[model samples]
Target: MSSVRIILNFLSGFGVLANIFLLVFYTFIILCHRPKPTDMISCQLTFIHIVLLITGPDIWLWDIFESLNIDNDFKCKTTFYINRMMRSLSICITCLLGVFQAVTISPSSSLLNKFKYKLKKYMISAFLFIWSFNLPFTCHRIIYSGAFTNVSETKQMKATKFCSLFSMNHIIRALILTVATSRDVFLVGLMLATSAYMVIILFRHKRQHKHLHSLSHLKASPEKRATQTILLLVVFFVVMYWVDFIISFTAILLRMYDPVILSIQKFVMNVYPTITPLIQISSDNRIINMLKHMQSLCHHIFKWR
Candidate 1:
């Protein structure tokens, strides 16, 4: 096997392991007890993460097979289409998670609250819309041609899969790039603005005091912890996603098409989903307390009965 093959295999294996760990952690949270709406959204994000992880390995595996001169056109096109679609869906769902959390934290008197009920009602519809909008891009995958094989190099030549644009003309490429970049920027901006609002609300809440007893309880409350967790999550997402955006933009401008850059992009994208479950678990004290209380009650009931 060539060096490229080895690297691809390594990344594929690592992604698989990371996704498995995330799945197990999410399962533990679910088995412990039912989760709140926010945690449920986080759990859904984890499921998307698992799907990405499972599909991620195939990209690398395809690269390995190509390097080793193994041709499989059917596998190439299928993997390419599935991977691209699922990855796009993952990105969309992640953005949705951020938006949902932000809305959930919005103050009751804020204008955003006026449409809060509509937001909840259209959550699934919005998700469906995202998927539908992205489906067209992936539909061209069916007509994608596998890479040409080099018969001189090896007796058993392998066909590689490359992203085939239905229209590779300058106009199409420019339009697609514009749309993708704009979408990403809009989502990132919204996320940052909402997070900033949340931080301001938290600071104001902290500065004000109710009664003495209420103040003491609030000081040691789960709400404070949840706020801290959300802040941390927002920070984590901002930093990671910014790094990815910078790298991606640089690559696009420089016209540098390297596998390493692609690999890093994939890694960063996958990390958010995997780590989301942990954030949800740590942030929600109610879930933890409920789990413990249920266990205790079960033990006592079993002993008495």
Candidate 2:
């Protein structure tokens, strides 16, 4: 395999394993204890990313699907549709994470304070709404994506070895692009707004508390830590999202999908998901404490044996 292929495979493998580990941890917390709404959201994010990575083209899944002898056009349509839907879900859930944190940290007097009580109550409903909202928008992918039979065809954009996007009429393409772009712009804008709100809340909290205590004595609260983590994730995700979006948009506009450019775009697309679990695992004290507790338990059991 070429160096780029090797690197992509390694990254995908690492991302899948990390996400799976994080998902298992969150599942344990949910089933064994009183789960926080954020935990549930994070768990769902991990699961979506897992699907996204697996469905991603030129990865391990292509060989598996090839072995199953599925019809090439059917494979193209199903894979592209699912991948597109997962991407939509990923952004929406990430935005929801920031919004939830913003509400969680809102002061009692703040206008967002009312949402604090409803975080858990409406969590499931919000997820359902997001899924329902994004699901229809991506149905266009199913209609346009099909097997790539000819590289000489300038109108088709090859997404993978088997799957390519067939040309749509100019009017249809423009309408679909507009709808997709609008969805992304709205979600990303909302995500940034929520992150900014969280930053303001955190700043005010620090200013209010700093006067009463020494800087060393002002340990960060769990909410503050969670907010900071989500902020980092939001910033990282936005940067990655825009980079991937530009590559995709340029490809669509030019009606060309160069292999090298596609490879780079795939690399960029997976970066956020790959790094997310690492950020959460390293920064979240809850995960750290849980790890410590498990370690001690294992040591005691081994020693007793």
Candidate 3:
């Protein structure tokens, strides 16, 4: 192992612990508040964060323990395929969240408002659609990856190896990459469009309700904050998605299977999942109120002393 990889592993190990803590925090918030109908997407986002943290960067951290008692190909393929599915699913959920919020704030007379009123009713069905859609696409990953024990190293190292089955067939490998890219592009495009539309609506509302914004700035603040929070999340997700996409394209098309490229891609992918929970807590009114109360309680106790 290189010094760089060792350092990366240590950092991600610590992040894994932090991610677990934040996962519990968000889960508790959802449980306590019983998320509102509009907030259901936020709850789903929280759960997706939990899924990604457990399966993303932690995969590398846990790879060291793989036992080659037998050819553990089954475990490797299963774990790798599941991780891919989780990563893809998280993106889909994010796009869903953007659309959900966009429709939510649309004017009552607009077509989007029609979706707004009905979206909460079909939240579970929408999630079911995401599952039914992305899960099947990731089945291709199982065909592409498997467990392999490398004998080149003195100690046997078993890891989930990708493109093992089709490494020799460049054309099929390219086709697989093309299909995955096209799917993501279409979905991400929707995310971009929705985010843009949401921004436009917010901008128009601010212009139309300037008096309301000034007279009851407190009321306007929460709505603006919520919209900004969702928009910021979509923007961050877009940056991460594009970075991963470009790296993925190079890694697949050019077969630039360098450790550095793989590590970079994995790091970018892991960063969002690990950090998203904190963002959720920041946006959550209930969680913020709880924190404020706890702060005052601690201060009062210390002051009494």
Candidate 4:
């Protein structure tokens, strides 16, 4: 129960609350307006985020649980299970969105134009695949996932390491790292490639048409803006992810305190999920307008009642 653990838990708890508040607002607007395809992607991402907010990383009711100073084996397994599932799914969905946006914005003559047509046609299948494909990998968490008798006063859940005592843990850790790093590297590369191509497309469009008032320019603006947002997201992901990876590897090498490593990773991972809705709000005028209308509707409804 170090001060660092307490502070990290408190911040995670706050982040969970913030995510919930913003999600409610975003959900209200989306439901009222009827979500478009891209909005549905946002909705899917947000849905995975509910698990993120309420489970893992000592975020779910952290203050309440920490004060009681108790954690169970069942709770640890369940939390980490959902954490593994949702983390995998979120990254998959994010990569999909990046690819979708890239293809959707590509010009008719571009090679990626084929993907624009196929993406919508295949999006449902893609989603289904994401769930089914990750199940096996996520289930692998069962090997070392469990609870501890020694729950610290500063923390409710002792960070469980089922493999820490085993000589075989190294082999298992290597396998886990291999699977995880391979997947991450592939997705990250896809995002970077798509982002770079999309940027090139945008610049080409601008160069071809210097006139901002042209019909093509107006049509291109929203696409470019959304793609740019995705690129920003990709940038953020790449930077934070590498930082976390390095820290995590170093922590393992040096045998750093579990709480310190947990605290660092928790803060690092939560950054994107916490702020994603705000990113959508800033980039999407449609959502903003819908929110405005929803606010007025609610105001009227309350007055009528």
What RMSD value applies to candidate 4? 4.9
Model 2 Cα lDDT, one tens digit per residue, 68-168: 98788888888888888999999999999999888888888989899887887988999999989888989989988898898685567777767788878
Clashing pairs in 2: none
Off by over 4 Å in 1: 1-35, 57-71, 140-145, 148-167, 210-224, 250-256, 259-263, 286-305
Ranking by TM-score: 2, 3, 4, 1
Q: Summarize candidate 4's per-residue lDDT along 81-159 as a digit string, tens digits.
A: 7887888888888888888888888888988897777888888898888989988887755556565443333232234
lDDT string for model 3 (1-305, tens) is: 76755755665555666556655665665687555554667666666665565565335524643544434556556666777888888888888888888887888888887776578888888889988987887886677565554434423222223223333366875786788878788888999999899889988987887666355653656656777788888888999998987887686555345567777887787777766666766776866888899999999999999
Per-residue lDDT of model 1, residues 193-253, tens digit only? 7678778877777667543555465554665576567667766777887887787776656
lDDT of candidate 2 at residue 292, scale 0 to 100: 96
Work out the TM-score per prediction: 0.69, 0.93, 0.81, 0.79
**What is each predicted model's overall lDDT from 0 to 1?**
0.62, 0.87, 0.70, 0.70
Candidate 3 stretches with Cα past 4 Å from truth are 1-3, 6-34, 57-72, 149-165, 168-175, 211-215, 301-305
Best by lDDT: 2
Worst 10 residues of 4 by lDDT: 159-168
